[model samples]
Target chain A: MSFSIDQILRGDIPRVERPPAADPSLVPVRLRVNGQDHDLQLEPRVSLLDALREFIGLTGTKKGCNQGACGACTVLVEGERVNSCLTFAIMHQGKDITTIEGLGTPDALHPLQAAFIEHDGYQCGYCTPGQICSAVAMLKEVEHGDASHVTSDLMATDVQLTDEEIRERMSGNVCRCGAYLGIVDSIRAVYEQQKGQ
Target chain B: MRAFTYTQATDASAALHAALQNPEAKYIGGGTNLVDLMREEVERPNEVIDINALPFSQIEVLPDGGVRLGALARNSHTANHPLVRQRYPVLAQAMLSAASPQLRNLATNAGNLLQRTRCYYFYDTTAPCNKRQPGSGCAAIHGVNRIHAILGTSEQCIATHPSDMAVALAALEAVVQVQGANGTRRIAMEEFHRLPGDHPEQDTTLGRDELITSIDLPALPSTANSLYFKVRERPSFAFALVSVAAVLELEGEQIKNVRLALGGVAHKPWRARTAEEALLGKPATAENFRQAAEAELQTAIAYEHNAFKIELAKRTIVRALLTLAERQLLA
Candidate 1:
């Protein structure tokens, strides 16, 4: 009745039969996560966050304030960041979902992850995955010339990642440890390193 | 969350047909607010229809220069669209000021317009909220109501609309395109959202079967010189206490045209027509802006916990207009 995350990632599980729309039974959901395909039979209301943790067994994405108030469940969908808790698993069938576990492993950490350890970006570390995941997409957003609430020049194609800009962009993730100074430093470090490259 | 059936509609007609077949079916796009409400048992639909497959996610520019935002377009995409950022910067600013980046990435433009209030009483099922259950009585009227509405409030509900993008859309005088079994039609932005009068349960004028297709922003050169000012409990990631969206056009030293809308102060976006009229043909000065703001807030009623909102709203309006005027001078 249960399968390991590795087995599921290896396509050991066959796709389940998709139930009719009128049937109130558990519907079949196909999710491609971190370049792996997962077929799960779930209720219509299962959130993407729950599906990732409970069904797919990728529990790195923390669930904080399941009502989308906090960003502990932040994940990348098609290279863009979103709160996994706020969306339904059935809704993201075709999108590419990237959770914290999908990011660089312990052996080869994502640049932000490496920078987080160097800068001590977390204390309890519950919000670290979400913060790092959010920072990963936040850098891409800025590189794509996306403006924030704090951005004064809306029409500018070039965006400068100031301290205020990073704080505003990462406001969704709440850290009880008050490790924002380190979080900002980690993101800035990676940002500067990337810019220099 | 209740057990429900799920269906992904391939087209608009199919979505409408499925909705017509199931009375308890809810069409979901983004699901940022709907899914949360469903988890809280605030919304219980027997069936959930996925409308993401429909081709209503494009951000197109009309031949007349106005922008057409597809109802299903993500908030982050719509806000960052070059047309919206260059010509409708106020809307971009308002949307960016409202939610976190993660939320903006998932939330859609039409869903933002249809989002319910952030009133504490409405969210707490234990509390009596007329908006949640009609005729249940309102708890926020006497309870903690610092975030309640100050304008267009009835005894049944004092909740304010929690949308910064809608406030900017109201100031821009956008139009909403909707389709139902009866066919397609458009509703003005000012008429799209309804005030909570005797019936607090109804949030908008949109019918249950009507599906919002797109939002059309009218081409206005004045919107180029616009600003969105939001005052929240925190620097970011909080609902607005008093937000102002101002579009100002200056003719020499006089105000040629002005559109003002106030958010976090009303059941719907409060279009400051009185203030717009007051500032029309007047000198573009800080004193005049203050007078116009006061005129707009003359009829704003406040509750016990939110009397400061009235003053805050007026000051924010004046500040927004003054900022826009200063920007015009520099330009």
Candidate 2:
């Protein structure tokens, strides 16, 4: 007799124990994170944020809400910014994930990193890692002619990175410290510098 | 979250088979909403079928000039698609206004259609939410329900469908393509999501084993002048308190065709057919728009803390229609 999902969820039937064949729980996930290849043995429920922090010991990516609502756990997956907490570790096997640690070093900081420091783009600095990572991807998105909510012209291939566009693009990375003005200034400085190049 | 088995489905058939064979299996694409629910133990799937590797991720123009968005197509990609931006600007605006840049990158088209309600009581397991647990009773009936539904609500539940994309799709009359163990089928956009009647547990008309393959957007010239206007607490990355997706086709100063839908006011992306029926063949004036909004919201039943939504939705509808009308005149 077939059982409904509700019945199985309520534990009405015996839990299925895998035979000597395949154990689907312990998945083997290989990811290139921060220019480092990591072979991880994780469950399907293990989020990418947990894998980075607990398994790989990259604690720089802060876990703010552990949900997509707050972008505190933002990271770059295949050069596209995403919420690490919402994605499974096994789902990102072949993709390149760049975290805060992979961004830059103390000796030579990324332009955005330097700008953030110069403009004091943070206060408590708890959400700084996610903010920087998101901004890096945001800048790339704008450079690639991606449009935001404030984009008036959809036909224009070259999206002008106005202050409103930057704010709209960077809206995902929340700075609870009320450092929005500084963050905007920091992003603008780096954007202008990059344009000069 | 509870420990669960996982298998990556490389194709749509495999995904459907896995979900059909396994009683507590769920197909995950993006996992923005499901992951959050899993964390709260609201969803306890014994097995997860990863459908990200499936071939359903392309935005193709149909032979009939319609746009077919693959189920796995990410929201950001779909929103920025040239065809979508030009032909369905309302959809692009809705997608861009939803969630955040990060979420839009990960969230898929079909996943957005199946997103659950954002009711605080539903997420909190300790609270009695009929949507989460049938017959558990609805705590949001008297609890802090400022964000709860104001229309299509029942005595059992008062939860709102929180998807700006779905609201626009509702207005566009998009079709959902699905495949199940029984075979493939297409569901109308308005019929895909169900009202919160007696069975509050059932969100969509999709069967447990059915896999959403793609969403088909039929070519409609009038939809080009449509708009999706959202009023939320925050400017970005916030769920709507009241939003309207309105499309209008004008014959000089008269409304020839119209489609109106409301978000943050119902169990589903409510297609405001009453409003559309009221405005059709009428003058495209502010007074006419106001009257149509009132007609749609006539039967609205709001809770204690959510009575403001009734008025908010009405004003949003009028504002959205006016904005579309003004743009049409400018064009």
What is the DockQ score of candidate 2, to 2 decimals? 0.38
Candidate 1 at residue B202, lDDT?
93
Whole-model Cα lDDT of every candidate shown, in order: 0.90, 0.88
Give the per-residue lDDT digits (tens) of candidate 2, residues A126-155.
888899999999989888777788898776
User: Model 1: how far is B238 from its true place, Å?
Assistant: 0.9
Q: Give per-residue CA lDDT, model 1, range B1-331, as digits (tens).
A: 6778889999999999999999999999988899878877788898899998899999998899889999999999999999999899899999999889999998999999999888866766766899999999998888767888898899999999999999999999999999998999999999999899998899999988889999999998743589899999899998899999989899887899999999999999999999999999999998998898888888888887899999999899989988988888888
Per-residue lDDT of candidate 1, residues A1-197 (tens digit): 34444653353543232333454578899999999999999887778999999999999999888878779999999999999999989888888999988999999899999999999999999999999999999999999999999998998989999999999999999998999999999999999999999
Q: What is the TM-score of chain A in candidate 2?
A: 0.86
For each candidate, what's the DockQ? 0.38, 0.38
Could you tell me every candidate's TM-score relative to the true structure?
Answer: 0.95, 0.94
Query: Highest DockQ: which candidate?
Result: 1
Candidate 2's residue-wise lDDT over B47-130, tens digit each?
Answer: 888999988899999998899999999999999998888889889999999999999999999999999998877876767888
Which stretches of candidate 2 lie above 4 Å from their native place?
Answer: A1-25, B222-224
Full-model lDDT, candidate 2? 0.88
Off by over 4 Å in 1: A1-24, B222-224
